[model samples]
Structure formats: C-alpha cells, structure tokens
Target: MLTGYQVAVIGGDARQLEIIRRLNEWDATVYLAGFDQLKEGFTEAIDLDFDSDQVERLDAIILPVAGTDDQGRVDGIFTNRLLHLTESWLKRTPSHCQIYTGISNDYFTQLTSHINRNLIPLMDRDDVAIFNSIPTVEGTIMMVIQHTDFTIHGSKVVVLGLGRVGTGLARTFAQLGAHVSVGVRSSASAARVYEMGLTPLDMNNLAEEMPECDIILNTVPAPVVQAAVIKQLPSHAVIIDLASKPGGTDFRYAEKRGIKAMLAPGLPGIVAPKTAGRIIADVISRLLKNSNREVDGS
Candidate 1:
C-alpha cells in the first residue's frame, strides 16, 4: 500500500485517470492539477492549483505520456487553461520526489537534472514498449483495413524498423497473409526478419521497394520516407507513419502527390486506452511499492 505517501498527478489525457484510480486504491494521498474541467466524479483525490504550496509534500509527480512540450506545457485534455511545469516549481518538491513520465525531451531532462530529481521515462522500458506494441499493432491493422480497399491477404506490405512495434507489425501482417517485408538497417535484424519467413530490405535503399508496396508502415522516428521515396510509391498505396508526431514520412509531399498518409502516434491510448492505462498503472504501482519498501528500510 502507498499509505502516507503523497502523489501529485499533473496534466494528462485519459490514461491519467487509471493512474489516479490505482494510486488512490493503494491508499496514497493523491492530488490533481490541471484538471479543472474534468468532472469524472473523482472522490479520493483532492484538486489543487499547479503551483500550490502542498507540492512540497509530494512523494511523486506523474506526468502524461507526452510529458511536457518544448516549453514545459503539460498536455491536459480536460482543461483549456495553459499548464506549465517550470524548473522553479519542481524545485519546490521534496528531494526524494521523483517525476514519472512516459517520454521526456531535452527540456524536461534538463529541468530534472537541475533540480537533482530522478526522472523516469516509462516508455523507454522494454516491458512497457513490448506490451504497448500489442495495442499498437491492433490499431495499425484497424487503420489499414479502414483506409485501404485491398485485403491484407496477398498485399505487398513494408514495415520500417524492426523494433518492438515494428516487429509486431511485420509479424502480424505476414501472419494475415500479407507479403511482409521489413526495412532493416542491421545485419542481425535482417537475419531475424529472414528467420521469421519475411523479406528484409536495406533501410537506406528503400526507393526501389516503395513502388510494389500496398501499405508502408514506418516506425522509425527519423525522416525515412522522404519526398524521393514517396514519389516512387503506387498512388493507391497507403502510408501509416506510426512514429511520434511529425512521423517519419514527408506529409507535405505525400499530400501533394495525392497519396494517403497518416501520422499515427500513441495508437494504444487512442484505440485501447483502458488496457494501455492499466499497463502503465501496474508498472507505476510496482515502482512506487519498491520505493516505499526502500524508504521503510524493509
């Protein structure tokens, strides 16, 4: 139980609700900020201003999956008010008050470092990423079916990146009878792709591969599918860039060429928020439990 432990849940989307519910069930003193517009019948947690004096008593601070933007603006779906997490605000928290977010940018990292507080990026963990890949693949398949006229069977599909999400996407499409080919940079990944009975191509030399593909799924965060690559694709082909915002595809060029392209990030949260939220809540609960044990010298 998180009894006597004080947690501040900052701005977030639907997933934050699960975290708050889980923490409250564990008997933590939960405080909410940046959720003035939310009327979800929250009874266990108390709402507070972003920079309330009670922040100094916090044992942990939970942020959304996106965390703060470049300017420390927290993403709160429930509120229109601008929420910012300044370095000074973080400094007010106790020394042991750790911040947990799904991902972090340079600005967030710098803020935590300057305050000498631990910052945990949950998405960076393999367990979380692998678990999240299940929902991501499901969402990807949903999009592919919705957007494309052709069936998955016998369609030429190309998946970029052999990471957790990429691997799941490649395997699922291949299993669904699509001719799945993965863009692999390393020889190890290429061999693994081959072992999985799917073809692998050089990620850098993707120009030739685009023309035959029915669906192009990009998981690489960088600009892999540029204008040069998009121009080679069949006009009927659909591009689903699953990387983070501003995905790997050239959106302007794709639009100009009349090709359908979608930049879809955080698919799990979109398609299956409850499952995704539970996954995060479990991890966060365990982490806090461990910290609780440490504090108790048990």
Candidate 2:
C-alpha cells in the first residue's frame, strides 16, 4: 500500500484517471493537478496545484502519457488552464522524487539532467509497448474498415518496420487472409517475417515493391516512405503511419499524388483508455510498491 506517501499526478486524459484509481486503491495521498473539471471526486485524490505544500513533499510525479509537448506544456482535457511544467518547479521536488512520463523531450531530458533526478519514460518499456499494440492494432483495423471500401481479405498489405507493432499487425493481417508484406531495415527482422509466412521486403526494394501494395502501414519512426516510394504506390493505396508525430510518410507528396495518409500516435488512448490506463497503472503501481514501502519505513 502507498500509505503515508504524497504523490502528485500532473496533466493527462482518461488513462491518468485509472492511474489515480490504482494509486487510491493502494492508499497513496494523491494531489491532482490540471483536473479541475473532473465531475466525480476521487475519495483519496485532492485537486491541488504546484504551489500547494504537498508539492515539496511529493515522493513521485506522474505526467501524461504524451508527456510534455515541444513547448513544455502538458495537455489537460479536464481543465481549461494551461499547465506548463518548468525546470525551476521540478527543482523544488525532493531529491529522491521520481518523475514518470510516457515519452521524454529536450526540456524534460535537460531538466532531469540539470536537477540530477530520474525521469522514467514509460514508452521505452517493452511491456508497455507490447500491451499498447493491442489497442493500436484494433484501432488500425477499425480505421481501415471505416476508410476503405475494399475488404482486408486477400488484399495486398505492406507493413513497414518489423518492430513490436509491425510484427503484430503483420500476423493479424495474415490471419485475416490478407497478403501481408513487411519491410524491414535489418536482415534478422526480414528472417522473422519469412518465418511468419509473410513476404519481407528490404528498404532498398520499397519503391519497387510498393506498386502492388493496397494498404501501406508504416511502423517506422523515420522517413522510409519518400516521394520515390510514394510515386510507385497505386492511386488507391492508403498509408497508415503508426509512428510518432509527423510519422514516416511524405504526406504532402502523397496528397499531390492522391494517396490517403494518416498519422496515428496515441491510438490506444483514443480507442480504449481504460485498458491503456490499466497497463500504465499496473506497471507504475509495481514500481511504486518499493517507494511506498520506503516511505513507510521513513
């Protein structure tokens, strides 16, 4: 249990609420920031700002899954107020205080480094990524169905990057009877694709191979689908870039050629916040178990 522990959960959407629920169940004293519009009150959570006394005694800081944007502002749907997390504010946290976020940025990296504190990036964890792929793949299928008139079965689908998301998508698409083709940077990933009974195309051959692709799903975070590859694609091909923001597609160029391209980052949060929230809450609660125990000892 998180008894006697003071934790501040910063800006986030629905998933953050589950984290709050889990924390409350563990008996942690939670200070909620940027949730002023929350209709239902959590029995154990009190809405407070950084100026409150609890901020100094905070044992942990929980940030949104998206983390802070490039501008250092944390996104908060529940509150109208703009919450900006700054270096000076974080410096006031206790030395052992840990800040948890899904992804890290330049500001977070530098601030944590200068302050000599630990900032946990949840997205970097394999467990989180693997679990998140469930909702992502579901949402991807839903989008594909809604956007495209054609059926997935027997369709020529090309998936870029054989990472966790790519691997899952490929296998699922194959199960749906779609002709799955995977593009991988490394030879090992290509071998894995072949083992899965899916066609593996190297990055060098993407342009040549994309002409027959009906559904182009890009899992690579870098620009692998350039104008050259874009030009080779059929006019009816749809590009689903599941990488981070901006994605890996040449969107403007795809548009010029009449290709449908979309950038989908936080699909898990969008499709199933409760399940996504549970994934985060489970990991975070396990991590905090020790910290909460230490607080009890202190």
Candidate 3:
C-alpha cells in the first residue's frame, strides 16, 4: 500500500475518477486538482488549485492520458475548463517528484526540459499499451459494426501502419475473418505482417489498393488518407482513424466522396473506462511502490 507517498491527480475524465479511487484505497495521500465539477465525498483526497505552490508538495503528479496539448493546456473534461502548465509551474515540482502522463508532445518536452525531470508517458510502456490495445481494438470493431453495412467476416480490411495499435487491429480484424492487409514502410515489418498470415503491402501503393477495400483503419498520425486516397476508396467503404486528435483521415474528402470517416481516439476510456482506469492504477501503483523502495534503500 502507498502509506506515505503523496499523489496529485490533475484533470481528467471519468476514467481518472477510478484512478483516484484506487489511489485512495491504497492509502496514498491523494490530492485532486480541477475536480470542481465532481460530486462531493472524496474526503481522503483534498481538492487543490493547479498552480506551482500546490504542485510542490506532491511526490508525483498524474496528468490525463492525453497529457497537455502543444499549448500547455490540459483538457479539464470533468470541469470544462482548461488547465495550463507553464514552465515555471513545472519547475516548482520537487526534484524527487515524478510526472506521469500518457503521451508527449513538443510542449510537454519543453516543460520537462525546464524542470530537468523525467516525464513518464504510460502509453509508451509496452505492457500498458499492449493491454490497452485490446480495448481499443474492441471499440474500433464496435464502431465498424455500428457504421458499416457489410459484415466484417468477408470485408476487405486495410490497416495503415504496423505499430502496436495497428498490429492489434489487424490481428483482431483478421481473426474476425476479414481479409486484412497492413501497410508498412519497412521490409521487416512487411515480412512480419506476412508471417502473421495477413497480406502486407507498401504504403506507397495505397491508392491502387484502395478501391477494393471495405474498411480502412489508419493508425498513422499524419494525413495518410488524403483527398487522393479517399477518392480512390469505394463509396461504401468506412475509414476509422485511430490516431490522436485530428486523426489520420481526411474527413472533408471522405465526406465529399460519401465515404464514412471517423476519428476514434481513446477507445479504452469509451468502451471500458473502469477496466482502463484499473489498469492505469495498477501500473502507477507499481511505479510508485518501486520509487518508495528505492528511496528507503537510499
């Protein structure tokens, strides 16, 4: 149990509520920031202002799974406010304290540099992400079923990118009897895709292969599914872009072509918030415990 370590959980959505609950259960001195919209009764955790003075007392700070954007603004989903994390505020965090976030960007990187402390992106952890991918793929499949007319059993599935999420998506679709084709840049990844019993193709030739596809899942963050690519897709095809905000698909082009395109980020929180929250709590708990052990040893 986290008997002595103090934790500050900043802005997040319903998923974060579970994290706070778990932390409180573990006996951590929990502080809740930007939780004004939440109903009362977290007596174990005090609500604090999101400023340097408040941040300095914590052993660790947990930001939302999306972390702050490029402008140093975190999404206050529960409160509907934007919390800014300036460089000076980051510098106020104790040297022994650690920052935990899901993803990183230029703003986060700059903030960390100013603080001269490491920021752990939990989403970058292989164990965390692989487990998280299950929920993400399930949610994506649910979206596909909800949006498309064709059954996945016989559909032509095109997955762009062969990263963790992309690989999980391809496998899930393939298992559902879809004819899965993965787009990859490297020959090694292409060969790995082939070894997995799925068709592997170079992303450079996506246009030629687009017309036959029934479902296009783009994991690439850039504009991979642009106007040209969308134009080549069948009118009935559905495009699911699982990348971060503003996803990978060209929404305007897809809409103009009568092809449905959706940016479905944060599938875990949407499909299974409780389970996702528990997973994050478990990982954070382990990390915190390890940190305490090291401190005690020193």
Which has the greatest TM-score? 1
lDDT of each: 0.88, 0.86, 0.85
TM-score of 2: 0.94
Off by over 4 Å in 3: 50-54, 292-298
Residue-level error in angstroms, candidate 2, position 3: 2.1
Clashes of each: 0, 0, 0
TM-score for all models, in order of appearance: 0.96, 0.94, 0.94
Q: Please give, for residues 1-298, the per-residue lDDT of candidate 2 as tens digits.
A: 7777788888889888888998898888999889888898787688766776667888889999889887678878888987888777888888878889998888777878889878889999998989989999998998898788899998999989888898889999999999998998788888899999998898876776664888988899898999999888778889999998879999999999999999988889889989999999888777776663385665
Which ranking of candidates, highest lDDT first?
A: 1, 2, 3
TM-score of 1: 0.96
RMSD of 1: 1.6
After best superposition, candidate 2 residue 236: deviation in angstroms?
A: 2.1
Model 3: per-residue Cα lDDT over 1-298, one tens digit each: 9887789888887779889999999999998877888875588888766643767777888889999888888886677778887887777777778888988898787778677877889999987898888889999999999998779999999999998999999999999999999998899999999999999978877766654788999899987888878887778988999999888788987887888889988889999988888889999999977884356742
After superposition on all CA atoms, how large is the RMSD of candidate 2? 1.8
Residue 205 shift from truth in candidate 2, angstroms: 4.0
Alpha-carbon shift of residue 204 in model 2 (angstroms): 3.7
